[model samples]
Target: MLLNNLTKKFKHWLPLAKSKIEKGASQLENSINNYDPKEIIPSKLIERLNTKLNSLPVYESYYDTLTINVHDYIHQWIINKEQNRKNCLVIKGNCVDNLYNILTSIFSEKSSLSKETIELDYQIFSLENLKQNRRDRLNYLQEKILEIQQQSDKKIILIPDLSYYFSRTIEGLEVLEKLLKLLDEDENKFWIIGCNHWLWLFLVKIYHWDAYIENARDLPLLSQENLQDILLPVLDLVEFDWNDLRRFLVELPNQNEDDHKIISQLQAKYFENLANLSQGCLGTASQLCFYSLRYVKNEETELSNLKINNPQLPDFPSITQSDRYLLFCIGLHGHLNKSDLANILGDDQIYITSQIECLVNLNLIHFLDHQNIAINPLFYSKLTKDLKDNHFLVESD
Candidate 1:
């Protein structure tokens, strides 16, 4: 009877023992990515954080906005907008260059017509300057820019994104070659052309593309102060508890007196580390900032409903080998639609479509539109490292 009772207890406890072992193993894996999450943060927290970020007016898409006395990344061009001569600019992409933000900068200059000019041209070229579109905006922009060009001794011609002109396909090669011919021959116009750094490298390898447009300047890497300035608009709009970043409350028995001083120091350190981790990419740093934000929803005290989740580098473990190469290709091109990806990989378009859909669901990739997909900025750094580890060629982040 006693033996029977012991067997029953053992049977009851076995499943619990097994579950604990499995849970421990799961935690071990998480530790490799980030400190074994001290708590299981519900997915809703991130959703809520995103909602709060979107609610802010100035927190527009990835371009650092026109707040804090800032224009877009085109500061030099803005300063020298009137140098009326046959000068040209080639903006080599550093991070995912959002051409729309470039338009916004021109808008900020009170040259709304100039913004329209760029918008129209981009529409004519293709979706994001890559696909086929039958919009009249293209014609309107071309006419407007030319009109402006004829009026001023020197007006700017901005090709916001060169990536839009071609894809990783046979026709794309012909299109880019033609574009090179245009750049070489159009010596009478003041022009500024932008291309993704990865895509630029690929073009250089294939067609010696840079030979046509010499001396492309890279977008500068932002420093801590620069990142802070970029996000100043969000900082004002978003509510975060400065107190949460304070360290060692237990160690500081008389902490109240030094609270302000400590918090100020921590705030500076926060952005400094953020700049380092994001490698000075404004878009990447912005996402990391959002990821670190949490809403406590408290209704008491000055900052009752806020906290800082210490920022950590995203270390996704579930990314597979195929995912790595697909991401590399996207990085190489700056963006790719399903069909574009299919053509490059020589895989069935249907299969390519499903794979990208799965990646989007997993949040490893995001859509620029209904068709074009790009790597999520948050994952770019890790993807770069993973590619290097696998002995794949990767450009600088």
Candidate 2:
């Protein structure tokens, strides 16, 4: 019965998704042709992307479709955060607003999802306002999604923002666990999980050592085309020449020396490293390269430090390749077999297997008998406990 239902959903949905992504890529290509990379896009990265997308065939499935509705997860977590004022709710407002707008616009013809016409106060964290206002706002948005999902019979397309949730801490992981549970139960859902800078780093830390190893096993080989597709957008956004940008930074009318020097160093090194990325791996390379140029928090700085000094790490080229593979896995749906892992990670499947062995030894993840990987059993139990203890549905201030 499950197989039959899944077959029906896939047949109905995959073609639709292929069309949407092809449209998105095509639209991006047009945007690049019509505008300058430096002035038009947020990042100076369009030419490289335009080239990559143009090179690839549009009708094929470039990557897996795994849409998990994080808004439901956020709605539940916000309720908990407000209930327990002790822990700071770390979510940024812009991210949540973007998510809400995306959800509402999917079901609209014009794709206008903002509440500009509505009279509700956008700020809900004030001391003077009633708490009910915030709850009401979130509930209203929630209903909008439920209606769309039910009306479309789950044809809702999802492109989740990586910034929507932080997974470095136990609380953040709690949110993801709940999200996975919801996704695990749903059918006919299509999504692309964008694990941008912060989320990428979070995965490196929280996915237990054992689970990480298990995940490393049976991993799909990262396709060159897939790497290019993913990286092109990032390159469009993040690629910048330090020498050129330095002049802009230094000669700006309002600049200070201290800030200028730091920005100069970061930008120079970032551009320098990016120049070495091969044509195939340019997209992921550019994305991570771009993230490094930004003002990373202290935690990120510490993580950077660890990767630099680690002895088991490969040469610069191999390390970046491995990193891109990991990113692809995080965004992809379904699981891989051991042969699949060799394909994605490279011919040196033994080394990849050894790395997985290391992660298992360290207790990051667990191997399921069914050729799939899971978070460690103990971490799974702990995650369950945290979800129950912090579940917004059952909590009261």
- Residues 1-397, candidate 2, lDDT per residue (tens digit)? 9999789767755544554455456546755665433222323333454445445442122112111123333233334433321111122111101222332233222222123212211211112231222223233434434543454232323323433232223343555554443333343332223333223333445443223211111112234444434444444534343343443343443344576676546444434443433222233333333333432224544422101110011112111223234323322211234554444444445444544443333333345444544333222223223333443112222
- Per-residue lDDT, model 2, residue 262, is 62
Residue-wise lDDT of candidate 1 within 1-397, one digit each (tens)?
9999789767745644554455456556655775423344355655564455444543233233222112222344445444322245566654354643453344333333334234322211223442233122333334444554345333445666665544565555655565565445543444566677767767766677655655466666678877675555566655667667655233433456576677666667788888999887766787788777655554455333546765667656465566667877777766776766777776667545545655665567897667778888887777666767775653433
Question: Alpha carbon lDDT of residue 272, candidate 1?
Answer: 85
Tell me the RMSD of model 1 versus the true structure: 12.3
Best by lDDT: 1
TM-score (C-alpha) between model 2 and the true structure: 0.23
Per-prediction RMSD in angstroms?
12.3, 23.0
The reply for model 1, stretches above 4 Å from the true place, is 1-87, 95-99, 103-155, 235-239, 248-259, 295-305, 316-321, 368-371, 388-397
Q: lDDT values of the candidates?
A: 0.57, 0.33
Pairs clashing in candidate 1?
A: 129-164, 130-164
